[model samples]
Target: MKDTSMPELRAMCFADLNNAVKIIQAHDEDDGEAAEADYRDAGFDNQYVLEVDGNIVGVTGYRDVPGTDQCHWLSWTYLQQSSQGQGLGKGMLLELIEKLRSENARKIFVKVSDYEDPELGKIYQQALQVYQGVGFKEEVVSNDFYDEGENQIILGLYLRDDEDQLEEDPAVSEEKPIIRFDGLFEIAETDGAYTFSWIVKETKKLFGKRNFSVGDLQVGLESVKNEGGRKVFLTFPSNLPLIHSPLQTAGFKYVGQLQNYYEHGVHEYHFTHDLNDL
Candidate 1:
């Protein structure tokens, strides 16, 4: 029988980390520890715990998509294994959406992994269905992103109905320019879907000598590929006109955009390259 009692959502405190971590681990032992550590380090301020009759049953939260005020990413949403199939997860999701909507969040996004194992994939499928039932749209999929067979699925929910599009500014020059890379890091990897990230350390060097070129991007892509990365993701401020063409030319597909991500008019454009296809 389903619990007739309603679950209460309350702000989670740093002290509640142990209990929350236990619940998360009970659901996913492999990734729960890392997720708990991440939440403890960076997510304490924005997270909440779901309590039913004074017992913690789940945890949920969202963080502002770095560089965006109105866009947010759903973080470490997990329910205790014992609580599965009780409809509590769906209710908690709706509550989180309502809370974000009230805060005037323009958009919310979440990443779901499609694992190689059939049983594990069903677990993610349930999660995907819950998000879809609440109007979240599938935006992009990076095949073999986690490893050899697992994939990463990005889903987004738009809180507002406004369509705000910006025109691209013309490139000043078409010549390939020298670019430098730094701070290469692995963003995340689960079930063999490895995603790598890096920074553009020296774009200023190309100011007058030449325009950002496709060759500059190819260099970075080749480096990531050499490192055995399955997918490479990069995000740049929409106002940076020179970076756009080189990205498209290097075969990076536009995954999605975060509105007002950098500022009022400037947005953050997300692009991805599938290393397997290369």
Candidate 2:
């Protein structure tokens, strides 16, 4: 039987990064490199490393979601391959949850992938099971998010059940529409599926007689489809009522919302348009 003793969780430091990279690489080489780069660029102020008998075996961390106080995102939760499959992942996750709860985190979220390949699917399945076992609920599944046939699964755990007090939308000023097409970028693609993101730079500009229109959206969608994109995603603050109509007219279906995403009472809504269905 594997030892069930809890591993020591210590604040990660720049000096510990080499060991962390090795631990992550043991599971995924590309991800390990990305994690190391992210740590270097962002720093490890909120990260922690798990140590078992003075040997670094894993790493985990959390970051406050921008524009919110109570919401947080799980970051870089990884364990060495040699240390996995022995119930260590659950223990580490529980510890991380406790840490977040103690810090008064009202909600925590994480993203996992659903891959088309059976072998790759099994890995994420185990991950999803772990998160679900710890009370994480599947909140959103962005189809073709990562690439063709690989979906992004967002899970959330609410530590507190406080009811949100909805706030009224503020009056809009009559000014030139300040919106800009942030650019269309490829989100993910595979042989069977391809997804792209259309980002609207400013919501306030959505109300005025602007260059953006339902027709514009249709053209963009068609252009992407012609280029072989199977899916397209767009997100915006729910407070922008004017934006919703055009999006709906463009045949974008509402996927889900992230509550308290922008501020208390406001939300970020996710919408997707499937080219194949159209």
Candidate 3:
């Protein structure tokens, strides 16, 4: 049997990658591959290894979110099956949270799957509890995110006091504006999933006719369809008052949201379109 005593957390080295994959693979094969890919893509600079008697028992890390200077997303956190049930996961994660807080980080988020199997018996639920116990707050929930039954819950932990962080929506005014499709791109993390970026041009008049309509959204849907994407995801800042009308008219559904993803109190509202529906 492996030693499970005297756990230590250390920076993971390149040599630890293979061993970490094996440890996680013992419990989940797909996640093992994902962990490897994440390390290769982002490097292991922020990742840590939790060890027992110098043997790696757990891996955890955070990655910076694009367009945000201080916000991060937790990545590929996992543990050896044997090391579980002893609070090592919580200890390791708490240490990571402290590290983030000390570094003047703003917030950290994690996406957890609500997947349960008869054999596994609500495995991810325990992870949810651990995260919540460590002060993570639920931000949004996307149903059927991974499959027909499994849902995705996004949680956030604020490392700093956010009472003064809220900002007014600068783009929204008393005037009508021009909204247009900006571009389309695949969500690198999921197959058949795509997102379209858009541009909203602020107008000068208080009563200018609304330049945005269902046509703008339809154009984006066509781009997704042309790219052979089955799903189109549109996430806008919740502070925007104009996006909802066009999106609803174009057959998009509100699925979920990510809290404060754009700016403080300006959350990301999730909308989805199924190309296969037609």
* lDDT score of residue 237 within candidate 1: 66
lDDT of 1 at 54: 82
Off by over 4 Å in 3: 1-6, 162-193, 197-213, 219-230, 275-277
lDDT of 3 by residue, 1-278 (tens): 32346465789889999998898787677777777887888798888899887788898889888776488999878878888898899988988887898898888999998878889787788889989999998978766555556667889888887552444544433323576666888865466678877677776566654666788778878878988788777777676687788889899999877766755655678888888774
In the range 1-278, model 2's lDDT, one tens digit per residue, is: 32357775789999999999988787667668878888998899879999887888889988787667678888888877788887778888888888887887878889887765556544667778989999988778887776666778998777765554334544433233334453465552233343334344454433655536787787778878887777788777667666777888889999998765655556678898988777
Candidate No. with top lDDT? 3
Better of 2 and 3 by TM-score: 3
Q: What TM-score should be assigned to candidate 2?
A: 0.77
Ranking of candidates on lDDT, top first: 3, 2, 1
Model 1 stretches astray by more than 4 angstroms: 1-5, 119-121, 161-180, 190-215, 237-239, 248-268, 274-278
User: What is the full ranking by TM-score, best candidate first?
Assistant: 3, 2, 1
lDDT of each: 0.71, 0.74, 0.78
TM-score of each: 0.77, 0.77, 0.79
The Cα RMSD in angstroms, rounded to one decimal, for candidate 2 relative to the true structure is 5.0
